[model samples]
Target: MKKCISFLTVCLLMAKLTTAQIIPSFEFGVKGGMNLSRFSHTATFATENRAGYLGGIYARAGGLGFNFQPELYITSKSVTVNSGSTQNKATFTSIDLPLLLGTKIGAFGVGGRFYTGPLVSFAINKDQNVGDALGNALHLNYKDQNLAWTFGAGLDLKKVSIDFRYEYGLTKQPYNNGNDETRINLFNLTLGYRLFSL
Candidate 1:
């Protein structure tokens, strides 16, 4: 009887450990990447896309199948604008906050993830130079706060992650004294590594 009881108790403990291994958990990481961004509007000035850099930290909850992630990053966005014969750049430096929900599929330390979320951005530099021609013509005024929706897919191999995402602006910044507005769009690619798991 003692032998049988000991065997059953060990089996139960092993089962509990197996269950914990399959359950979702928490992780935190850091990421950095580049972004290609452009402005969208009906303005007469021609706009061109520009590349910029971003770096940040992210925390994720849940794993195995589903996860919720929140990230904070600093990003630089820019566009080159041409007004007839003159050309200049308009750049914005901002802090970004993104909240995302994602699903993961795969096994054996490798997986693919798809996520979508909302992002809020606060501009660190409110003044933008559009050149004398475009600035005088549009009387551009930039807003301090902006919002967007982002969607992305990623690949995870062990502790490394790579993601590609698109951000579509939902709010417009007014120019010409609130009479005209424009939105910003971006494509982002990032590489991240897990710092730890809990």
Candidate 2:
């Protein structure tokens, strides 16, 4: 494990060197937006989208047409279960980090931006027992970590950016019956601003 970490560190150092030497459009930014999150079921499960919050900070490097962007965010989202006439929701607060590779979509890096990558999330919310609107006890098993695939597009307007992305879960839900799988997916639209440049 230590050897792997050392190797990755060396690779990152090489990338930083290459970026610093070849490209100079480094920027640090902040973003905040809303998310429409829901569960995508494989079987017959009725659920609706839930509104959530997303806010974060990010750093950009390598910008002579292509760049690498990594962001850390505090995100809140939920999934609603349709049980008869009453709706039950499970909300999770997570720390999400996405490492993306992006490139300019237009002329000489002046057009639009496209990015896609893996998102790592750790649920900061703990296990709790709650009652539904009709007073049924709900027991939950909490899982701390999840892996997701994220892809998106953005328009860069100098110091600001407008982005849209989708995140799909690669694992099972934290709380579920063993009979089927419940995966969550979210649509995110964000507006961001570059606070500084390097």
Candidate 3:
């Protein structure tokens, strides 16, 4: 309940900022790319790295060396687990909201920007089939909501942009046992094109 309230407060603050805004330029775009993800598990669980996908749309509003970016995107995380002779894989999906405040620096031809912000994510779906080789499947329950931080840099040239980012999960995911937990962490590279500029 506290987390939900905090999120609401952040939203209200952003709304207030928007009402007083005077941005010189606004650009809307689509981005998609591959992500390499892994789980940082406690001593009770062993896990490996796996690959996933991420894609989303974003709007950037600002100019004159600064920008405010807000995005709504879908992200995926995967991990590999080994238990005895059985190697299992699990993937989870979530919706991510990122609010970024940063500055851009470049010349007449291209622009480069670095941004850092908080990410609020909600897990929507997951696919896990652990312990299947042992004749039964194990169930894992994780929290639906999570908080994270992202920092990255990107370059914009013409209508194309590319960026690299790292996200560290602040909230840990817990299994049914409660004592066992894992935090999702990953690095992502994305390529985007401006579909429209407003």
Candidate 4:
């Protein structure tokens, strides 16, 4: 009976150690960034890219090799369009959510990371000033929801992180009474600081 109890205790301890080793560290942080965006298809309208900004919070789970990150942010995007003698500007504000999977390579509080993810955006507001002729001709309307794919690389030094990412639109916005569609692409740079880790 004594031998059986001793063996069981040892087994339990080993299991606990194994479980601890498998779990990864967790981190929470805040981030903000600037972005440049343009419409993919301008058609008759000449489109010019415009600068935008975003600010958000993020959480990361994992260690040295593989990590999962999820983020929530508010972003503003804009573009200027010119058709013949008419010129107009459009701006969109939205809430963005991104779910990313990443791989890290480095040690001793410094690392390089590569990540890819899907992002979903919900539009909070859309503002555009169009000429009467342009509005009637294009039948322009803004979408309430949008989707995209994000690919990026980043560097982490101690508690600070910097990233450069490109977002490709996976969905299209319809216009011209649904006869035409357009997609938007964006490039952004972000800076982040770790708030806490466990």
TM-score of 3: 0.73
Candidate 2 shows a clash count of: 0
Looking at model 4, residue 77 earns an lDDT score of: 84
Per residue, candidate 1 scores C-alpha lDDT tens digits across 36-118 of: 98878565867888999889898888644578988878888887777688886777677787889988766556778899999
Report the number of backbone clashes for model 1.
Answer: 0
Candidate 1 residue pairs in clash (backbone atoms < 3 Å) = none
Q: List the residue pairs that clash in candidate 2.
A: none
lDDT of 4 at 166: 96
Measured with C-alpha atoms, the lDDT of residue 16 in candidate 2 is 61
Q: What TM-score does structure 2 among the candidates reach?
A: 0.74
Instruction: Tell me how candidate 1 scores on lDDT.
Output: 0.79
Candidate 4 minimal-lDDT segment of 10 residues: 133-142
For residue 86, what is the lDDT in candidate 3?
71
For all predictions, the C-alpha RMSD in Å is: 9.3, 12.9, 14.3, 10.5
Candidate 3 lDDT tens digits, 1-198: 999999998888666444423447788999988788777765646778788988889888886557898876777788886656777677777767777888776543377889999877766643422222112111222244678899989998978989888889888876433555678888889898898887
How many collisions per candidate? Answer: 0, 0, 0, 0
